[model samples]
Target: MKIIIGSLNPTKVGAVKKVFNQYKVEGLNVPSNVSNQPLTDQETMQGAINRAYNARIAGESEIGIGLEGGVIIENDRLFLCNWGALVYENEVILASGAKILLPSEFINELRNGTELSVLMEQYTNEKDIRSKEGAVGVFTNGRITRTEIFEHICELLFGQYEFKKRKEENN
Candidate 1:
């Protein structure tokens, strides 16, 4: 099957490739049609959905996958969140990765319109940290990576897709 990933970021594309290893995967910089830095769960999911839909429409691929990472606030604390969406024909499968609570230092900066990605880069002194270890990696002391987060999301998405396809086949 042909799969189109709605991002050129190596981490995101690599995760999708790992999940759909048997298929032909193409990475493209499709528009998410949402905030550059989503600040809420709903917005982050919307970004993923938009990217998935746009990627599906951008080519003749059988599946389109989109992964988006952002920060969300719950109970006055900021947390790292990641969401993914898989689109197949008229069906869309969605899944999310585990959230890691961000430090209090990020709360004020985030509320002051500072993007998490920027903060992460500054905090780690590593450029393009989002495309590398990511905030999850730094917060977890490298226990979890951005690619791992997206990979897990892809696994969940693929599982749901397989079930849906089998259900349709049985029907």
Candidate 2:
């Protein structure tokens, strides 16, 4: 199947391609000029949906995927969260992360409208928003990059394919 990923982040593209390659899914990167304006959990998912929908309208691919992330506050705590969406032949699959906690100060900063990327930049001093190597980098460590966060979200949305394959083998 021809799948288009809606983002220009290299880490996200690479991670999605790595997993999709195992299933023999031909993946293509479709960069979106859309704004990265995700301030809340709902808005984050909206960003992904917008990207995926835009990609589908812009291409002939059989599938389009979008990944978006943001920080959300709950129970007096700040959490790093993500959402993913898949659009294919009129079907849409969406999924999100289970809240991951952040530092108290970071939490306060985020609630003030500071984007996660900027927070990461000031905390890590790396100045690269896609590396996931700064403050939040600890979550991914060396196992995955920041860009992979979106890829991971996509995996959560599409991972059922692997589960189905496993079930078929047992049958």
Q: Can you write out model 2's per-residue Cα lDDT over 1-171, one digit (the tens) per residue?
A: 676777666655665687576543333455433345354688777877776777666656767777766666777777777777777666677888555677667766665667677877776666766544423455556554455565567677677645655786999
Name the top TM-score candidate. Answer: 1
RMSD of 1: 1.0
Q: Which run of 10 residues does model 2 get worst, by summed lDDT?
A: 24-33
Q: Model-by-model lDDT, in order?
A: 0.91, 0.65
What TM-score should be assigned to candidate 1?
0.96
Every model's Cα RMSD, please? 1.0, 4.2
Q: How many steric overlaps are in each model, in order?
A: 0, 0
